[model samples]
Structures are given as C-alpha cells and as structure tokens.
Target: MPTEFQKRAGVFVGLVTCLLLPMWRSELYCYTVLCCFILGGTLEYWTAVYSRVSSLQDWAVYLILFMVWVLPTMAALHIYGGVIGHTRLVECLIIQLVVGDSAQLIVGRSIGRHHVCVKLSPKKTLEGYVGGFVLTFMYGALVHGWSPLNISVVYVFGCIGDLYFSGIKRRLGIKDYSRILSSHGGLLDRIDSFMFAANALVWKAFFFSPE
Candidate 1:
C-alpha cells in the first residue's frame, strides 16, 4: 500500500534516526537538524505553492522561504528565556505536531463535511479543526509533567498554528508542500504542523510562562 515515496521517505527517516541519535543530542545538534529540516521543508512549501515558479527561481523562493522558518527556530533556541528543558521543548513540538495531524485524520473520517478550499483540499473541514484542537491540548498535558500552562493555552495556539500552515497550503493551490514524502508528501508537508507547534511553544516558553 505504501507508495515509492513513502518507502523512500521511511528509509530516509530511519537513516536520520541512525545518524543523529548517536551524537548525544546537543542544542547545536538540535539546531543543525532543525535547520536542515526547515530548509528542506521550506523548499518543498515554496515549490508547491508558487505554481508559476520556474525551476531556476525555485532557489530564490526557497532561500526567501527558509528565513520564514529559520529565524523563529534560532530565536527559540537562543533567545527563548523559557524554563523549558531541551527535552520538554522537543517533546512538546513533536507531540503537538503529531496530535494536530491525528486531528486531521479524525476530522476527515468523521465530520469533515464542508470543503476547506473546495479545489485545494476538499477533505479539510472545520470538524478537523476541533479534532486538532482537542488532540493538541491533550498532548500538551504531557508537558505539564515538566513545565507550566493550562490546557487552553497549549492546544488553542497549537491548533491555530497547524491550521495556519494548512491554510497557507490551500492558498498556494497545492498539497503537502511537495510529493517528496510519497504518501506523506514533501518535507514541508510533514513539518508544517511542527513549525506551527514549535512557534507556539516558543511563544509560551519565552513570553508568557510564569516559570
């Protein structure tokens, strides 16, 4: 059932795990991995959205888009004064993303009646929004073990972030940023949820948290 892209991506992800897990996981290591993932994902996004872009211009668009995702990462890594331990920050970002995506699946399967964009992504719906919110909030509960925040703040912002990126994809007239992920699509498709959730986490940790 898996497409060629899925098989390839699965392998690549496995490779990444092997390559990175042995390094002892420093902030610098996290930063580098985050940087590469964002850059690859951004390239996928601009390529998918800007339909009129030529292959030559893809580089330019990618470079421009890279900034959109990168500055936030840098800020979170360096300037984020939040008391979030590295493990907590990582856990929150990854978990919220997974929750948001699971929400999409639930909404699509159940109440996704109205088309999100009609043409761009027909299955996306307000129902999915609810799913994403609930899931994201629930996942945020995991962070309470290590950090601060009530459920409302965590899921609300996290869901908004996922929807924000989803909206961007819809407007760009593409799906999943790229088909590079096969069933998963490009790096952007997989990571958009992460970007939104990470940004939300950064905001909470640096600006609002009493800790």
Candidate 2:
C-alpha cells in the first residue's frame, strides 16, 4: 500500500492534468474527458453497490444509472456550453474539489469532534464542512466574482454529494470504490462532489441566468 503522502501526490498530479486539459485542449476534448469520467464513475458505483448479480434490483439499478451517469452527463453537456463554458467551469470545479476538499480533510483531522455522519464518513465533521465552504467561497469569489449565492449553493451541494456517495460505500461494506488510483481510491470517489456541483451550476446557469 502507498503511504499517505504518495497517495496525495498522485491525486495532485491527476488534478494538475485535469486542469491543464481544458486550457490546452478544445472544449470538445474537455467534454470527452468529462464523458469518460462519468462512464468510469458509473461502472465503479455499480460495482461497489451491487457486488453480486443477485444483489441488483431493477429500480435501484436504474436509479443509480440515472444519478451516476445520466444526470452528470447532462450537466457536463450544459457546462460545456453554458455561459461560463467548459474551460472556466472545469477550472472552478477542480479548484472546489481539490482546494476545498483538502481543507475539509485537514480541518476535519485536526479539530473535528463533531462528525457530520459518523456512519457514512467518520472523517468528515461540521468544522471541516464550514472550513471547506469558507475556503471555497473565497476562492470562487476571487476567481469568478462576489456571487455569494452561487458559491454557497455549489459548496452545499458538493458536500451533500460527497456524503451521499460515502453513505453508499458504507452501506455496501466497501472501503474504497476501487483501487484504480492506487491509494486514492476510484475515480468516482474523487469526482462525487464535482458531479453534483456541476449539475447544480449548470441548472442555475440554464434556468436562472440573467440576460
């Protein structure tokens, strides 16, 4: 098994590659990358939740499919063309996932007595969530603008999304989604928050943006 530092370093490298793709490539390329992630995450989710063929149910499978695949794909498509466009949106998403999540982990470990959901993710805490939101809000405001509402909404949904997936993992009795990223777990674990936040942002952009 890789050490904690090695795991974090690997994740950092992956994040840097993801961030550079949009800046260096076209919107289509970014979209393609997003599609790949959505597909990969979907498979990982299915495997984690339904480890055996007999454990799968029709409704549950469909729901998982929609949530993990369809919704994120729609969000990715909209994000590719929304006012912010794919590049900028992806940049912000990466920042929220990387910086925001890092803050959550650090703060949670250092001074996190109140667990947000002890059963789902014991490492997560209310203090960590607050710290993450503060950092995320500051970063978003600095980069995008003083869009407090948008920042708050995205951060909230992101945390919820992370917890949602964590709950799934706990229920399924699995440690990580997969060992695809070595000690960092699967792609789904990394992008659970991103998928939810992207969907919310795309919805806001599409139906609520001012002309």
Candidate 3:
C-alpha cells in the first residue's frame, strides 16, 4: 500500500519523464498531453454533473461543460500550436504553476491565518496566496523572463480556476472529480488551474503579443 505522497510522486515522475524526453523533438507529444487533460477532465466533469441530478436541462449542462472544460482546452491548443508555434513558453508557465502551487500549500500550512474563501475552499488562505504569488513572480521573472502582466494573468486566473472547480465539487457533494489517481483524485483535479491559466494566456497572447 503506497502512501498518498508516494503515489503522487510516482505519477509525477513518470509524467515528467514522458513529457521532457521527447518534448523538443516532437510537438505532437505535447499536444497529446493537453488532449489527455481535456478528455479526462471532460469525463470527470460530466460524471459529476450527471451524478448531481440537477434540474437543469441537458443542453444547459452540456453548454456549461463545453465552456468550462472544452473551450479552454481548444484555446490552449490554438495558442501553443497555431499562435505561438512553440511549447517553450507554455512549459515555463507550467513550471511556474507547479512552483507556485507548492509554495501556497507549504506557506498556507505553516503560517496561514486568514481564509481566502471559506465557503468555496476552506483551506485556502490569504497568506498562502501571497506567498505563492511572490515566489511565482520571482521564478518567472528571473528564470523565464515572463513579463509582469503574464505572471499576473497566470496567478489570478489560476486562483479563479481552482475556485471554480472547488465550487463545482462543493455543489456536487464530492471531494474529488474522480478517484482515478489514488490520493490525487483525478487528472482534472491536478490540471484544472493549469487549463484555466493556459486559456487565459491564449487570449493574452492573441490580443497582446506582438509576435
């Protein structure tokens, strides 16, 4: 019986090896990873919605699902494949997100005192958020040359994305979208914030990037 941390670490190492080994030689591999996220996320989302047995119409549910999961994923593909024509920038963003998320967890547990949203996410705190933001900014600025605006977009929308999914889970009366990943819930649970931030970056790059 593996512990939760072991499961997480094992999966993470495998994923990193797969992504980094062939990432530079072939862009298709990266797209495949994104597609997996969207597909898994969509399934988990649909399962949650259907299980809730809401009074909303089927069309309404589908529309919400498309907007929340599918649309953002498509937008991300466009940004990375068509618009930017490279995965380097997005890779940096992913690294920053990982760093920031870890920071938030560590700082929140260590010294966090004020909850950011008690109703939506009880464990999230203002101190944690600030710590994550500061560290993310430093890493992105120093290592990736990410502009302040880009860092801001990722941090802000990442928070929004996490809360948005948390809201869904709260409404659905479930702790996770699925239990596929052992202690980590599901693929969607891990990449929800990344998906949202990626799509937000898509729009920013589309309208703002001179390239």
Candidate 4:
C-alpha cells in the first residue's frame, strides 16, 4: 500500500507530464489540457456552490462570480500559449509555481512555527511563506530574469489563490474539492496558484519587457 506522500508524488508527476508534454508536442494538445482543467474546475465549483445554496437569487450571484473569476484566470493560459505563442514562458511559470508551492509545504511542515492565517488556512505559516517567497524569487531571477513585481505577483497571488479556495471550502464545509487526484484533491486545488499567477502576470508580460 502506498503512503499518502507517494500517492501525491505519483499524481503530481503525472499531472506535470500531461501539462508539459502537450506544450512541447502540439498547441491542440495544450488547449485540450486547458479545456479539461477548466471544465473540471467549473464542475467542482458548481458542485460546491450548488450544494450549499438553495435560492436561485443566490445561485445567480455565484454564477456571475464564476464567470468573472474563473474564466479570466484560466484564460490567461490561453493568452500566453495561444495568443502570445510563448509556450516556454508558460512552462517556466508552471515550474516556478510548482516549486514555490512545494517549498511552502516542505518548509512549512518542517520548521514553520507562526501561522499566517489560522482561520482561512490553518496549515499555512509565516516561515513557509518566506521560504517560498525567497526561493521562488531567486529561482525566477536566475531562470527568467523577472522583475521584483513579477516575482511578487507570482508568489503573493499564489498565496492569495490558495487562501481563496480555502475560504470557499471552509464556507462550503468540505475538504479537498474532490477526490479526483487522490491525496492532492482536484485539478483546481493543484493549479489554483498557477491560475492566479498567470492571470496576474500575463498582462504585464504583454505590456512590458519581463526579460
């Protein structure tokens, strides 16, 4: 029997392969992967919202919020990959987000003492936040020569993205979003930070020289 960590690692590798392989091989595959993620995330969002709310009036508000929040964030990937033809750029962003998130988890579990937000995300810690921030900033600088603002957008908004989903889960009284990804929960849970970082930084990349 595999332990929880093993299950998580397996799923993580598979997910990364699916995402990066498509980027290297074909644009169609990339879009296909994105569509799958958007559809899965949308369904999960709908499930959580629908289960909690009863009134159509309340549903209307959530529906609108969904359109506004989810679509634009996810579409940022398309802007980079499809519109900009910057697949490597997307790849770098994905790697940084993944590494930063992994750093947060590892450092948080090992030496984290002070909680960042006990109510929104009890497991998050200040030490973990700093660890992720410093490491991601350095890595981004070395790899992409990204500006401080760009690095901040990726790290800070990544944290915000995590907390955003966490707040939703707390409100809806559930965990993991869905059991689709074994120990890692749903696709949305895994890519929440990426979605937010891309959405926040993609436009900046368009307007200014990040290199």
User: What are the per-model numbers of colliding residue pairs?
Assistant: 1, 0, 0, 0
Q: Lowest-lDDT window of 10 residues in candidate 3?
A: 88-97
RMSD of each candidate relative to the true structure: 5.3, 2.9, 2.6, 2.5
lDDT of 4: 0.73
lDDT of residue 162 for candidate 4 = 83
Whole-model lDDT, candidate 1? Answer: 0.59
Ten contiguous residues minimizing lDDT sum, candidate 4:
82-91
Candidate 2 Cα outliers beyond 4 Å, as residue runs: 1-6, 18-25, 53-69, 75-79
What is residue 190's positional error in candidate 3, in angstroms? 0.8
* Weakest lDDT window of 10 consecutive positions for candidate 1: 143-152
Residue 156 lDDT, candidate 4, scale 0-100: 85
- How good is model 2 by TM-score? 0.84
> Using Cα atoms with residue i matched to residue i, what is each candidate's TM-score against the true structure?
0.66, 0.84, 0.86, 0.85
Q: How well does candidate 3 score on lDDT at residue 49?
A: 77
Best by TM-score: 3
Model 1: pairs clashing at backbone N, Cα or C within 3 Å: 181-185
Could you give candidate 4's per-residue lDDT for residues 53-169 as a string of tens digits?
898888887777677668776667567764445564455445456668877887888899999788889999999999878888887778767677778877787788888878777
Better of 3 and 4 by TM-score: 3
lDDT of 3 by residue, 140-187 (tens): 788877788878888888888888888778867899999997677987
lDDT of every model, 2 decimals: 0.59, 0.72, 0.74, 0.73
List where candidate 4 sits over 4 angstroms from the true fold.
1-8, 74-78, 82-84, 207-211
